[model samples]
Target chain A: MSEATSELYSWRASIIKKQLMALTGLMMCGFLLVHLAGNLLLLKGSDVFNQFAYLMVNNPIIIGLEWLLLLVFLMHTTIGFRLILENQRARTKAYAVRSTVARGSKFAFISMSVTGPLMMVFIIVHLFDLKFGSEYLVVQSDLEVRDLYRTVVEFYSSEVNVAIYIAAMCATALHVQHGFWSAFQTFGLSHARYNRLVELSSDVFALVILIGFGMIPIYFLLGYS
Target chain B: MRFTLRIWRQAQQETTGRFVDFAVEDIPAEMSLLELLDSINRGLILESADPVAFDHDCREGICGMCSLVINGRPHGPGAGTTTCQLYMRSFADGETIVVEPFRADAFPVVKDLIVDRSAFDRIIAAGGYVTVTTGQTPEANDILVAKENAEEAMDAAACIGCGACVAACKNASAMLFVAAKVSHLSLLPQGQPEKSRRVLTMVREMDQSGFGNCSNEAECEAVCPKEISIGHIARMNRQYLFAMLLSGERS
Candidate 1:
């Protein structure tokens, strides 16, 4: 395509991507909160957590929900890849001298050009380890409830795995930190006090998830398991 | 105080542009940025070189004509102020300043520090105005616009068509400019009849003019001489989407 046609195409694609990312990211955020609540059952004890996991695994309703989650994950990844590729292509021409006006959240958003794909890889690895690995309880015919907890513990016991998980959590945290406020801004949700509150909540939620997910691996590494 | 001014000079739209440097000495600190340019112009004339060409009428910031990118900022560093109002005191003595006309593929250079922003005028001509017949003046209170809406209309109307937002933008997007015109008229009851067409035509013109798409960076709001809110851009987007979906179907 010619530059003009290509430019117009990319502009439309960007608008579509913006809407898709916001919708998917918001949905995933809701899922994360619920997932966190469910996982907190581990704090109660192994039986409670395992029973919860078992119930989820055995229920046909949840099986349907799992399919929906997979669909959402696929859509999110596809849109993310398109966005990243377009951004890279847009900036392929190197600037002889960078303009001084480059500042603030604009730079942050451009840097997301790098962080977004990293987060995608992290998510895939995350799903593979927890959902499809040998430790996955749903795949084992004679799986005991306690075996689920042991599998999680054993997965984190390896130093290399622990390190990888922590890095992934950090990338996820940064992605959420920038993406949350940006989605709000894009949707025209700007009231100063409310936006500040949203920003605070985003930061707090990101920190909590990072620490929450990071702690699991550290727990095993430090012999808590 | 002495300062080096790196000013862009170009004779025509098709010609290549480059920055040329000149030094001015013993300049008063309180002189407005425009006045500083005037001083340089005077110096150029005395030295028998071509006087630096720039556009300005109302030197008092209200007229948006005096647009410049000063030290990489639209209308210098002062927030919510135009180039004509930006005083030389904002800069330190011996500071090197770079001045350039608004750079955009849509806004081609006409001369040094002056661009043909006629693209804006064309976009406005696309359908920026309300369709009222010329006759006796209507009573102000005849149309009962809610006070908030009236205020918003006035705020949007404050956009001076300065083109600073375009110059300040990374992609040279004209969303802020187009939004101002669209929102200004759209806010009032008198402007409602042609509102749908106004947004559609203006946005189409904006895109056709080779302006880039808005990424919601808010840089336009940051550099706008009128301090027009990015909220207008959102309103414009909403209106455009509605117009595209509803109005286009009827047509």
Candidate 2:
């Protein structure tokens, strides 16, 4: 009974679980956009970057928002992993030789389960690399704040850092390619013809995540810092 | 055509099953897969050997009675065709065709190439019908359905309640089947009276039947004999969402 029937039993419970997953996933996607914008400030020099980072870390509302974002992240991952396990359990007896002729982004479609854990591991490693990494303090606006800009630049300066980031962003991009439009589909908003608009936007946003986050490590690796 | 057919064989509902190969010969290209099975069964009967048991009623494509996983693709090869309609020419002349029962917890194998699909019957029984009855035949024009809605309804109505969608789905999910059932009815005015109740209870039964959640992979749509689209699934989600939101109304 490790698999919660509530997760797969009732239509109400199942719908709510997927709804929560879509909501939390969209919230985190929004956070990724905001985080990308914040990190891009590193190009503006340590002073401006530290000033913004310091303000962000010190603001009570921002602290609360960060905690809420963590909660959302946890919810998305937990529901996703459980559903993956439950789905696999759905067919205990396997086909001796199974194949699918269904087309249209099947790699991204099936890769969600794989990318779910990849993103989790990447996020944990990413947090440890910067958020809880060695803190360097510098005077910004007549106050000592954590020099997150220097930390970021120094961390991404390594070729290893850049490589891991590129791979992580690729995985995220693959996941997002499906996850973005899938969130809308989960909410019952889809069109046979016009869903292409949402599907295209999903692809575009995935590219944005890849390029926006991916540029940082490569930018620093190119010795821009 | 000559071929080796590895057909699954099980004596009873509780018994274990395994593939038993038969080297079938002198099959005409025009013979349907089910007819080929008939020929093989006759040979087995003449030899006093146990014949392979499979489900097949109407040899035509529409009945949804024929079920087989020929070489992993349900209903054999070719798109939008059922096993009853699949001809021997679709396969290589001497290829080994592997046939197995549909695998899912909800669909236990009753015999060779016949998984019990009563779960679908139960899901339909739950809420797939309209409550109001007309004693006499009514004029079709009285309903006044939009052209597009009628087309979509007809499209969804094409689903034959075959378990091919369930067999072909990696998760063995029945969303496509249930979606088609829910949608064809929900799109019509005659079916409007119990719309909310229909979606809610049918989905509840589906969940209880031990079918997996839809991951939107859509192999169900691909392998469906009728080529039922997953768009109905999205519509089902929409209906289910509103049904849950408006549950207390008992519509």
Candidate 3:
């Protein structure tokens, strides 16, 4: 009540943690959108897809953005885990039998706790197969540039890898389904008329990201590679 | 009407409690839940038994003093109505009703159907008031306010500080109560000065009181006697974030 000594610092830290979560969530959602758009280029054939990948890694501006991307992911994940742990600690005892009478989006609320850690593992495996793993690489065009297009196609050509990729994309979709609009709400960007539009747009965005990335694995699995 | 009641009874704050069953017969259908309890208490007194010690004041439903979780629903089955407003007719004849005190780590059971909700009072005390000069009242129109803003502020102001939201929440979070208080003040012209500091201080008290974080469960809004929306929680989150993240200033 007095804005006492120890409590003030904890309050500041809690609010700061929530803000960081929203900021990093927005950044990661943006990254997912751009990543989806670029991945869609794979359908246009190997030349265009490889060229896009080549430019993404070679361009100084885009390369700098990757570092920023890493920073955002690091902050988002670290703070997310901290908030989850703190929230868990806040409730001293669990109800003998708990039931939610509120008309909550139960799927969205419960799945976030699952998809977040799943996405973390998915990102690591995804980077290894496409970015760092050299076993799947193919040399192309006399310039000897690594053919990232072949790397993606060959990686997905295995049924096991394709299954893993699809599973990860599903987790991403579920995470964004809740995270997209939640980030906006956390920032206080709500109105009676406009919030409905935001919710609709978030659903569409989640679907597009999932389906767009979903096609590549299906394409390679279907012998189109 | 005759009904069976299973009520939670605790010996003290340090001991465990359990449900004690009683058959309450010959009750009128129009009797309010509190009246039904009163009838049961009179019967117990005649038998030289310890009567239930639930809290109540101004049983007409405005005081927010009545706290009961009837049939596992806070404030009974009705939406936007308190326990005192709930009548015996809401339940069928010869039915069993289970009543318990609002549960939360911060709200310990004081006795049968009573909890120490002083936690809410502490949260309100943190920053629920505006600092004003000691002088004559200002003219009503001295500070122009938008009509819509006034209405919204009044809506948030309808909260009775009842612990239904805390009881309804799965994690026993008090976000709705805090949001109502925060937005009620922050929406008005007089509340602008301490807007940033108010949110920062109140939320800190909420966390320190050992209440859980809001998972957007929305049970609070569902069971609220005033039907306060979770939208206020969003507004509180926004204000708290903006104050700490962008301004980077204490006040």
Question: Candidate 2: misplaced stretches above 4 Å?
Answer: A1-12, A108-110
Residue-level error in angstroms, candidate 2, position A33: 1.4
Worst 10 residues of 2 chain B by lDDT: B242-251
lDDT of 3 at B198: 87
Tell me how far the alpha carbon of residue A89 in candidate 2 is from the true structure, in angstroms, after superposition.
Answer: 2.0
Question: What digit string (tens of lDDT, one per residue) describes model 1 on residues A1-225?
Answer: 013331212334233356567678877777777777776666665666777888888899989988887788788788777655543332332222224443224344444556678877877887777766655434334555434666777788899998988887777777777667666654546564586787777788788878887776686688865
Answer with 1 or 2, whichever has the higher DockQ. Answer: 2
**Chain A superposition TM-score per model:** 0.81, 0.91, 0.89
Tell how far residue B184 is off in model 3, in angstroms: 1.7
Candidate 1: regions farther than 4 A off: A1-17, A38-111, A128-171, A189-200, B9-19, B42-53, B101-104, B108-112, B241-250
Give the TM-score of chain A in candidate 2. 0.91
lDDT of 1 by residue, B151-183 (tens): 999999999999988887665778789889998
Candidate DockQ values, in order, are 0.17, 0.45, 0.32
Which residue pairs of candidate 1 clash? none
CA displacement after TM-score superposition, residue A123 of candidate 3 (Å): 2.8
Tens-digit lDDT track of model 2 for B1-251:
89998888989878887778889888899998888888898989999987788898888898888888889899988899999988999999999999898888789988777889999999899889986665988776876999999999999999998899989888788889999999999999888988888887788778778887776767888899998888898898888888877655442
lDDT of each: 0.73, 0.84, 0.81
What lDDT score is found at residue A157 in candidate 2?
83
Q: Report the C-alpha displacement of residue A51, candidate 1, in angstroms.
A: 5.0
